[model samples]
Target: MATKPRMHLALDFSWTQVETDWRQPTSWVNRFYPDIGLFEDVARICERGLFDLIFFGDSTGIPNTWEGRIDAAVRRGVAWPRMDMSPWITAMSRVTSHVGFGLTYASTFMHPYYTARLLNALDHVTNGRIAFNVITSQRKADFQNYGYDELVEHGERYDRMEEFVDVCKKLWASVDPDAFVWDPVSGIVADPAKVRPINHVGRFFKVKGPLSVPPSPQGRPVLVQAGGSPRGVRASARFVDHVFGAGKGLALMAEQRVKLDEALRAEGRDPQQVGILWATKVIVAETEAEALRLKERLIADVPMEAVGAWLSHNTGFDMSTLPPRFSLRALNQRIVAANASPVGFVGLLAEQYGEDMEISRDEFFRHGLHAATGYASTKAGTPVQIADYLEEMFEATGSRGGFMLGHSQAGHRAVLQNITTMLVPALQRRGRMRTAYEGRTLRENLAAS
Candidate 1:
């Protein structure tokens, strides 16, 4: 029998776009920031498109890495003033049933007990429609916020993440599914014997007790991760059910998936059971010419300054100080040794090009400086063309998992509108994407996909 073809689509929800993009009429500006209605509207649209989830990528600090100053980020609104995703997600859940919310919470700072209690409550509130995007934060400022003088080393961070997740897992499993008795005649709310303390003790965390809240409908929220480093990959393989792949382009994504699959095998897991969603940008229109024109405009409008600030925040290395002619080795050494960036620049280069390939400083700068602004992996064209690319990429990458759609500018109003109205319908007509959700919960929907 032939294998079935399907795509798991998600939206990248963040505040950076509304803050950074100054030219257009941003969705947040018109709709107002921190408004529940805005999130509800987007969630409703995502439900209409049968999108699996709306992922909220977050950071803990106001980045000051660009030229060692926070003014640029403040001035440009580049990743500053991040609102907590919990409230909006809760509100969105009340308005939509099928769509899931992928909420990011860093394990580096939060304790396992708190995380367990919080997510458990959220899962119940969302009716089992939540996915946790686990992140081992690497930004130095984020560490400072948590009272650490410096960010921990990359490998060590992952080490802690493993323990942190282990503690959370133990806590989640502490309460049995059938623990709830609710027997009025016997006057029993739950079986005390069924609920017990996990009493976990590990390298990074030690938790002793059962979670305060019971398991939601899906048992536990789906585990989502976006780790790009080798250690990060291993951690994801051990814990994640869905991986938000960090690399761009077909080859990069394929390479990431292969690495993840290898890790899964090492951990005694079937690769097919773990979903890998590639991060990509798309611009669709009624006509091919219109899409091409829009793509050009969006690309042209991408400010190199904004790109530099964004890079600084991601890598934790200031990109503005690099001279026209600089050494790639020096840059990589600084990034790695200082633990300046969350995802090392060298790691990214290896993902794009082979690890063994020799890359000059000039080539690195050319690629790194403006890379964020350009939609090199963009699916831009008419709805049909966009759908064709989605199907082709889906097949090329082992015919499973799918893309998490992102837009270049902040707010991303146009991209969301076009995708909901045009591209999603096109994919549905081709039988590549779903018209209606397959299950009530996020995990079930993801499993079906």
Candidate 2:
């Protein structure tokens, strides 16, 4: 008998609007504070709905990488100057009962020691309701901000991540769970026996062991990373518990999922352990037409120039440098990678686009691959429509789950309303997903049947 699938919602909220509009910081995202209004509403709603974790995505680099202008990046509201998501997530932890928070930051650029200490502190602050979305920083311009001559090549960047993640793991392990025990009778806040120095030496990093903070809830916050290149698969295979991706169709994404798992085991890691999650967007309404109308309005509201900037920064190529026809067969492999053997970098150009290699790269860009719009008809009509599509997605990919929702207006609130009121109940009727959280921490939720 087939066991039912478990669905977990991960939010990329806060600075969630990657829309290439909204020039001012005030316009970027309303109420950056997590303890206050919208975020609070979002938290309470998701908690009631029993979401596993809602991830807070923050990019160190601007969307201005393509055009070399911060102005366009700022106007579009694409990951601009932002508050550290960790502190805000701590605020959410104070309010919510279950639901963990996954905070995203770059693994490629930042020093691993700082990453370890910061994440460990968040783990303490959130009482273990935290996870890390390990990322190889995106912008070529970010390297310049940190005073580097150029962006590290793709393969080299993943190599750095391998070392960086190792260092973080060691740092997390350094402070034993039994290290801190306050007792006034004997007078010992922490045991000296528990302090283990890391003294780790690697090609990219060197850290003396033992993090200062002790374990709080989960042994170590769950490690999460998004799908990038094939080298990304190898990196994720070794470290990520959940891998996030976005695409236009479930079938296309399912194909990607298979490739990811194969890459995982090829790297000698158990592919089954790593969950392949599709990064997606689903705008729901009481009616299918209503949803379509709303989507059209949102797309129109987005400025073409802003979208152009997003495209440039993301693909890491100046649109002016290459038209639609130039085969992007080769990216700076130090950064971008080919999928499977002789596979076009599906992370950039899905294999579908490569059949006509002579097609303009610009033409290929318009195919809606970066965005996992999902569904052939572009409609998740009624509660049943959404549920049916979600189930099909799981069946197609053999994925434990698919990731939908992110930081935006009513990010969690909107999703929870849709899930609890419409989606979840619909799935429950069909015998997929869960009615409640399985555990108190993020990992527990991910593992819960």
What is the per-residue lDDT of model 1 for residues 43-63, given as tens digits with 9 covering 90 to 100?
888888889999899998988
Give the runs in model 1 whose Cα sits over 4 Å from its true position: 1-3, 26-28, 299-303, 342-346, 349-369, 409-412
**Looking at candidate 1, what is the lDDT of residue 410?**
27
Error of 2 at 142 (Å): 1.7
Taking all chains together, the TM-score of candidate 1 against the true structure is 0.93
The local lDDT score (0 to 100) that residue 333 gets in candidate 1 is: 64
Candidate with top lDDT is 1
**lDDT score, candidate 1, position 162:** 88
Which regions of candidate 2 fall more than 4 Å away from where they truly are?
1-3, 18-35, 266-269, 324-350, 355-379, 406-416
Every model's TM-score? 0.93, 0.85
Q: Give the per-residue lDDT of model 2 (tens digit) for 1-449.
A: 78776666765564543452132233323444323555666677777766777777665666555556777767655556556666667777888878778888787678888888888788777767788888776566566667865566667777888889888887888777888889989898998888889899888887886777776578887998875556777778778888877544666677678888788777787766677656555656678886665444334444545555655555555444445455545433322431112222333353555533555554544442223112222343567777777777777887565565533223323434765567667777776767777676777778765
> What TM-score would you give candidate 2 relative to the actual structure?
0.85
- Scored by lDDT, model 1 comes in at 0.77
